[model samples]
Target: MDIKAVQSSYARWAPVYDKTFGAITNVGRRCAVEYINSRGGSVLEVGVGTGLSLEQYKPDMHVTGIDFSAEMLQKARDKVQALELSQVEELRKMDARTLDFPDNHFDTIAAMHVLSVVPEPEKVMAEIARVCKPGGKVVITNHFERKQGVIASLERLFAPFANTIGWHSDFEIETVLQEDALTLEEQRALPPLGMMTFLVLGKSGG
Candidate 1:
């Protein structure tokens, strides 16, 4: 998906996101947040759409979020204000392909149901690896293309319509695992018929 398409698609979805896509992705979101909270520290959440998982973080955990869509960020900011979520340190408009933070800035980084939606996911993954602290965790939850089955066929069928659908149905997991500095620690199938996957990648260090 191109960046413009992503921005426009999310602008359209922002209004009903929490009740629609957000609800469907709830299981994976909760799972990621719970895992991060257990190892609380400074967190950087990529594609923090609507901040649905904001309040779930432990109060002691400092979180910073970024998104390319202004429409979506507004919703997130509103949630932070209305709920008085002090753990949310800041929310900025930023491109994942070029993160603004310094090297090894965050103890944890989260990308939830977002990689497929962003353009050049490989670049985004590299940026993620760059800013994550050594030995820190990068938690991800996303729908990857099925290898074989009825779903695989459907994925291929919709591959061309990524710009319209707002995400790539045939996105591969290898796209995220290419960063050598990040080692895969765990991988598992998530709920809703296992269409989504949960991954934990630990940055290498002492």
Candidate 2:
């Protein structure tokens, strides 16, 4: 998807996101956050739309979130204020392709159910690798296209509507795995018929 498509699609979905796509992706979010909480430290949460996972982060873990949508970020900000979540250090509007943070900044980075929605995911992944501290982990949860199955057929059917739907149904896992500095450490399928996947990639040094 292009930036305009992403922006417009999310602007439309932002109002009902928590009950719609957000609910469908809840398991992935929970699994990712639980794992991050276990490895508590400085975290950079990419695509932290509406801050749905913000409250679940352990209080001891320092968290910073970034998103491209102002509408979504506002909701996230409101949630942070209402809940008084002290762990959240900041939430900024940013493009994942060009993250504003310095190199080796965060201990962990989370990209939950968002790679397919953003433009230039490879560039985003490169930026993710660049900023993550060596030995830190990049956690991801996303729906990847199946090779052959009823799901694969369904994915093809919806592939054309990615811009309108706000996420690519045929998104490939390889798009996020090409960064040399990050090595795949774990991979697993998530619930709801294993449509979604959980991945952990460790940065190459400490």
Candidate 3:
């Protein structure tokens, strides 16, 4: 997929993406934030679309968000401003594959619905792990192609159209994450939503 094209597409869809995908995403965000809080840490959220998850974050936790779309960042900026959280939240236009923070920088890094859309999942995960303190947590939630059954067939069938619109790779996230030594702490599917996976992973030998 073309990075520029994907960015442009998201920029165009920024206004409606949240409303269209909010139902499931709202649950995903809550889940991600809860997991992060459970681990207790300074947090970073990648691909924070319209800042829907901002409210889910506890006020005591400091957070930084990064996304590639300016328009989407604009919406998120507006949201942070509206909520009077400008001092606590920082949203930047950035690529997940190449995070700007220093090594072992954050205690928790959340990537909600971000990996599947990126061209380099492994690189992004590596960057995520690099900035996380040892034993720190990495939370990821993304739409995936079910291993089997009717849903998988539908995903395969419409993949062409979906690919053109915004969707990217739908490969097994478990296999991908494991390859980079990010141990899966927990994995569960969100009920009634078979296409997505909510996962909590920890750094190896942390």
Candidate 4:
């Protein structure tokens, strides 16, 4: 995938991103935040689009987010500033494939719906793993292209185009995490979007 093109496209769509995909279950957002909050320490959020997950995070928790698009970060900045969380939250424009943080620096790391858009999803996830503490968690969710069938066939046909516009690959959740040695702790499947799956994974430091 073209990173610049993806960034530009998201720059244009950042304004309406939340309202559109936001139509999906707020449950996922809430669950992600609560899970991170429960850890009670510094958090790193990759691809923090429009701050939809902010509503669920506690203001006391230290949170830092990074994204590839300054335009998207702009929308998120307003909310962080509005909530007086500027002290606790630092938003930076960055590429997920190469994170700037040191090893084992975060208590929790999240990449909600982020794996799909990057050119190298596995590399990004590995980077997420590298920054996370030995036992830290990585929360991820994406609408997958269902298993071999008519729907899957159709998705495969249009995948190249869909991918260009920031849609997900047909990757199975398990496959992505396997290379990083992360253990899945929970899973949630979105209704109607059978391909959509949410997972909470723990780094084994193995």
Candidate 5:
């Protein structure tokens, strides 16, 4: 999906996101953050829609969230205020492909359920790698195209409507593996029948 398509689709999703997609994605988010908290440090959540994971972050870790959708970000901002989550440093509206942070800025960067939805995911990966500290890690949770199954057939069927749905059902794991600075460290399957995958990539020398 293009930028406008993502923005519009998320605008519609923002209102009910914490109850809908947020609920469905809760497992992956929890797993990612739990791992992150174990390795505690400054964090950047790329597509932090509605800030569902904000309150879960350990208080010792500094967290900053960014998203392209203003509506989604507003909800996230509201959550931060409501919960008084001091761990959250900020919530900014920024495009994934062009991040505003300096090089090697964050200790960990988490992109939960967002790689397939953004435009130019490789560019997003590049930026993620660029901003990540040399010894830091990046966490990704997403659904990739299944090779064969009833779900694989459904994913293919829904492939053409990516823009409308806001995520490519046929999106591949390799698309987010473009950053040379990052090395794949771990991979695993998530709950709800393993429909999603959790990935961990450590920057070279991290």
Candidate 6:
């Protein structure tokens, strides 16, 4: 996926994002946050669109969120300020592929519903692995393209519309696994006919 394409698509979607895309992604976000809350540490949330999941985090946990879309980030910022969400350490307007944070910064990093929308997803994964503390966990929630069946065919057909849709319908699981620093710890399927996947990856060392 291209960065500009992602940006433009999000810009258009930003107005109705909460009622639309945000609702659809709620299940994965909830599951990811519940798991993170149990771990309870410094967290970095990549692609924190509209801050829909911000209020659900534990009040004591420090959460830093980053998103590539300025418009989307603005909505997130508004939510934080309006709700006085002190748990949100920051809501940054930044790119995922080249995170500005120092290496090994966050104790737990999350990439919920974001991997498929980013350009050079491998680079984004590398950044996630880099800023994550060794032995830390990275939680990911996204729709991975299926291998067969009618859904797979539809995904392939919609592959060309990624630029317009803002995410890859045919995104593969392997794209985000290229970062060698992380090892898959667990995997599971989420709601709505199990279209979305939840993956728990651990940074290789302590």
- TM-score on alpha carbons, each prediction: 0.98, 0.99, 0.92, 0.89, 0.98, 0.98
For each predicted model, how many residue pairs clash, with residues at least 3 apart or on different chains? Answer: 0, 0, 0, 1, 1, 0
- Relative to the true structure, candidate 2 reaches a TM of 0.99
Q: If ranked by lDDT, best first, what sequence of candidates would result?
A: 2, 1, 6, 5, 3, 4
Q: Write the per-residue lDDT of candidate 2 for residues 140-184, one digit (tens) a residue.
A: 999999999899999999999988988999999999988999999
Whole-model Cα lDDT of every candidate shown, in order: 0.96, 0.96, 0.78, 0.77, 0.93, 0.94
Candidate 3 Cα lDDT to native: 0.78
Say what the RMSD of model 1 is.
0.7
**What global local distance difference test value does model 1 have?**
0.96
Clashing pairs in 4: 144-195
Task: Tell me the deviation in Å of residue 27 in model 4.
Answer: 2.9
Judged by whole-model lDDT over C-alpha atoms, candidate 4 comes out at 0.77
Between prediction 2 and prediction 5, which has the larger TM-score?
2
Q: Model 1 over residues 39-58: C-alpha lDDT tens digits?
A: 98999999999999999998
lDDT of 4 by residue, 23-43 (tens): 574656666777788878889
Query: Where's the lowest-lDDT run of ten residues in candidate 2?
Result: 174-183
Backbone clash pairs for candidate 5 read 135-206
TM-score: model 1 vs. ground truth = 0.98
Off by over 4 Å in 5: none
The residue-by-residue lDDT of candidate 5 on 34-84, one tens digit each, is 999998989999999889999999988899999999999999898899999
Q: Which runs of model 1 end up more than 4 angstroms from their true locations? A: none
Model 4: worst 10 consecutive residues (lDDT sum): 162-171
- Which pairs in model 2 have colliding backbones? none
